[model samples]
Target chain A: MKLYEHEALGSIFKKYKIPVPRYVFSAEMNDAVRQFVDKEPGVVIKSMVLVGKRGKAGAVKVVSDKSQVEKVFSDLATREVYGERSIGALVEEKLDIEKEFYLSVTYSTKDRAPAIIFSEHGGMDVEEIDPKLIHTYIVSDVRSVYPYQIRQFLAGIGFSDKELLRPLSEVIVNVYNAFWGSESRLLEINPLVVARSGDKRKIVAADAVVILDDDASVNPAVVYGARSAQGRPLTQREQDAILIDQGDHRGKAGSYVELDGDIAMMTFGGGGSTVTAETAIEAGLRIANLTDIGGNPPAEKMYRISRIILSKPGLKGVLVCGGTASNTRIDVTLGEGLAKALDDMNAEGKLDKNLVWVVRRSGPEYVKGLKMLHECFVRNGIRGEIYDSQLPITEAPIRLKELLIKLVGYKPEEVV
Target chain B: MKGTVYLNDKTGIVVIGATGREASQVIKESETLYPGIIKAGITPGKGGSSELPVPVFDTLKEAVSDPKVGKLLNTALIYVPPVSVLDAVMECLDNGIKVLYIITEHVPIRDSEVIYQEKVRRGAIIVGGTSLGCFVPSVGRIGAIGGKDPTVAFRDGGIVVISKSGGLTVTTAEMFKRRGWGTYMALAIGGDIISNTTYADVLQEIKGDPRVKGVVMLGEPGGSYEEQVAGLIMSGGFDKPVAAFISGRFQERMPEGVAFGHAGAIVERGMGKATDKIARLEAAGKKYPVKVAFYYHDLVKTIESLGVPRDFEDSTTEHVKPLYSTF
Candidate 1:
């Protein structure tokens, strides 16, 4: 997951003995900047938010005077950056920059290995930098990043001076070590400053962004204290989904994301879910939320997921689709869990009277499951259509869209 | 024959973490469906006890030391937790397991990298870390892939099926079953960001098997595995007709960096788009003459049009013999 703020990454860099700018994290607009401003000529104020491109969002500001620091701090602290409210503000001692450099490490799917990218131009968008100035090196193994490779890359990027290359290469090695140690998927140091103050020149990381892998097995509690997808706190629905999956070991029914759409879509399997979502969208159905109910989840978990999907506002219909089940019993996920959930919603008047439901599933006991779903929908006085595994999974969305246009009185263009 | 991978009657099997909940359930089901396949079990501390007729050992070393296990074991079905998957894999490799089917999910990428490197060094084939495993009809099912009832969707035939999604593996098999076609073998390589095996790896094996007259590949948007398959096809790796379906085309409309479903199912920096995969595969198909299926049902039509060998003209009248006669 992405690190929430610069402070989190700074702490990690410090642990690796990498030099970073002195900084202090604060929630209040009070004297946080006073200490940093007195130590350095200027202080950089940054909003502590999970979202990126803070500089472009005006969430970052540099001020030399203490009087200006409070205004800039309040401006960033009060505003929301990329839909996420700032938890606090970071005040760091600004560095005396003689030269700026960019360094990052990430897995390259093309190479199927860890790759490092270094650029002499930093403190700006690396994408806009000249392609000739960027040097990329892909490591064949994850065990170690050789120093000679770093020297080679630096030299390729026109770092011919030995004195400059020596310190820069050392910083790169430390950053690589930190990335490897934390099992991070992404580690970026933008504007790795070459500070020339008085008669001393030192290389230091001015800004850092680190995203650790979600797998807790590598280093438990290395990044976030708890397992989380987004850097920020989990939404209520997300927490409920996690609880439901953890409550039992029978099957997996987690990873729920609420989307801005009118159709409540519950899909089975990871790849299956994406394909279902894409198909639904293609057929002119906007998905209200995405739910994965696979690995043969029990009826209880399925009911909870279904209920949550229906509870979302502006839902015009519900679509439950998945790849043909192998080990997952269709009777449990669809017949008992999903149908039961719809019945409850109908009873509670939570479901719209005109809402249409469509389900396409296949596997062992699919006939019985389909029959049970048909009976439940009929008993609940719900308008619905059901297709067994005989139909290709890709047809679920197109079929559902057609049904919605016909039964719900939706226009052809509206239902598309 | 040297690079080909296949599961047959002679392939012995062992289950790691055999005493675990999911593993135990799968073992019991497999035992009922196909006996005499699972030869041994491995649980770190739950050795000496038996998970039914299959004997248990504390370690891979201990399990392989037994003359009965040493003589028969060739494949390992791993069901260990994510934390211990790397160690379990190393142990299996150290003990001479040639083929590994890791059913565990959420394995750390770092550990996966190490496992992958070691696998290459040892020249072993690994199926998955988050996979449902493979099924060779009339031979045996290595993992809980074809569900509680394998015969419902699978049979011995001329088609070899490979998919990244576990659910689709059975679904594709069902499609073939509906069309009076049967699968020679079906495998799910897992939908994780990094799978031990890819469509190309399985396709290479299918090329060597004369029984596999055609191939069906179910790929999704995310990694370049689909592109790799296209590359192989362009290189003329197989002589049989190949019908490919790449899902998640709508992800291109969604926001970048937002994963639609699987960990690997994300489009970033304009890479791993369903559109790109489709375009590349279609372009390659022109040169290689592969059939590209946009809609899922189209796969069946593509395969049928190619006229792969089949047993029955109509699925309604034919009653194929079940792998397990007792069932």
Candidate 2:
């Protein structure tokens, strides 16, 4: 789950006591945003979208004239940056003239440990800076990392100004705390500015780029509503599929991303789903969605996902494929779960008899599961066949393509 | 023996979160393949009980104190929840358990970092946090690699398989089974973003093992694990043929940073893209016997083109004369 700038500032930054510039966010010219712009000498108007590069995308603007505040806010709020429309716009108090520093806490996969990357040079084009200008520390323990160590490192890095060292180092340490506390995969503060306001001096995080741990058990994930793979709001069917794994840890059928295709994909397993989707797409089967349904989700979960998958409009076929499961019982997921869903939908006259079907699954009780599912197909008059381990896991998608061409009248010219 | 660092039939096992329903099923199913290997269970309050097939203990400390389990307890299979994974792993590391397979998922990244530190400190082999486990078809199983019936999914032969996805681990093995050269050892190293046992780490370990002939790798997007394996093969660390099939190529066409389900399986700004991984592997193929399969089913054909033996006969055994018996 990736947090929007407003969310990270509100939920994580304040909780960790990371000093942040005063800001107000709203979808419209609400009183909070209006009052914030009126009181502040200057404000930075930022579009509240999860994707990055707001400035390059022309979604961020600075307003000094009070007359232009509402204009800028309305413009940013209504703008679509990088294929994602703004949820809202964040009006923040513009910081004073200051020096900027870079700090981020993330797990460096190369080192296989948490890494704190600090750079004396920060702000835009920080990536273009000299390699030696940046300093990195492999954090053995985030808890044991003290302020003095960072303060000393700051002093050693030519930031001999004793005043800037303490506040800067403290915020750097607080970023780590915020990262671990929020269970974030990445917590980056580019241009952690050393700004002076009137007679007061402060160190503030000017930007927050956070990628929270996607695990459902995480605090942020629990608090924040789910977003689509495109980092946009979920569709109605996507929203419906999410409830399947809300409180249930039994298995995982909730991970579904709708695509612009006709075939409703109910793929299983993280690896299995990927392999199946790749084969399905390469075999010229336009997959409607992608799901990592494995760990043997219950019949209820399976039934819910099946309904959501079938509910998509303009479905040419339904392709349910997965690799040979090691532990996931085929009978429960396919037979009891998916078969029941087919029966219920058919009874409701919601089943599309014209849509072709192809299912390939294996694992515990696969024989019984395939038999039950095949019977459901027979009863519903659906054009489909069931396959077991004898079929190469990748062959299912090709089989679906062949059936689509022969039965559904799909053209071979569409083949990639 | 599978390998010195790996599990075998004689490896005494301890199950964390043992009394849980899923753990019980894993214990029951695993016992069928390697009976009596599971010596004890740890549930933090189920001490002195026999709820699972093995004796249940309040903690790993109590389980290790018992003379019956202490000497033989060398491997651990953790089925605990995400939060308790670090502590459970610490306990196992402290108990001198050299080989550990963690089956838990959604483990916080911080916990994984700490586990990585402890694993380095103790020099223990840690498999997964979201792994289905590993198996040596010739010896026994650890975790839930082969499901209920090992024979249905796995057959002991020559090729070694290392997959990030547990389901593909079995699929890769089944793909090899049809060609008559069944998997010698298969390890589902987990789909976690911070994977402990990578393709390179496992490849380095199994490189010297006489049983495994060719390597079958299943990779997803995200992380440099596959790239690291290519580096290893190029450096001549592993002198065996390798065939790899990387998935999630279609996502590269969608968007840069959309994490398609698996956190590790993502294409972010040309980094960890299927195209880059394939190009790297193909580049390394010039240095060693590395073949990159564009399609999943075509992976076996790539390995077969490398001239890997169809059976589990090392070069030494291939030339030995058989003893004649009196009829």
Which digits, one per residue and each the tens of the lDDT, describe model 1 over residues A1-416?
67755654556788887788788877876654566567777888898886778899988888887678778887777678877778788888787889888888877766667778888788887777897888888877667676777888777767755787777777788888887777877888887888987899989887888877766454434435543343346667776776676535567786687767888888888767766777777677878777767777788888898887777777787788887777677888888998899888887888676778777877767878878877777787777777776556777777778777777765433432
Across residues A346-393, which tens digit of lDDT does each residue of candidate 2 receive? 999999989888788888888888888877888877777677766777
Q: Give the interface RMSD of candidate 1.
A: 7.9
TM-score (C-alpha) between model 1 and the true structure: 0.90
Top DockQ: which candidate number? 1
* Worst 10-residue lDDT window, candidate 1 chain B: B318-327
As for candidate 1, its clashing pairs are A283-A416
Q: Could you give candidate 1's per-residue lDDT for residues B52-83 as a string of tens digits?
A: 56899888888788987768998999998787
TM-score of each: 0.90, 0.93
What lDDT, from 0 to 1, does candidate 2 have?
0.82
Top model number, lDDT: 2
Report the Cα lDDT for residue A32, model 1: 47
Cα misplacement distance, residue B16 of candidate 2 (Å): 1.1
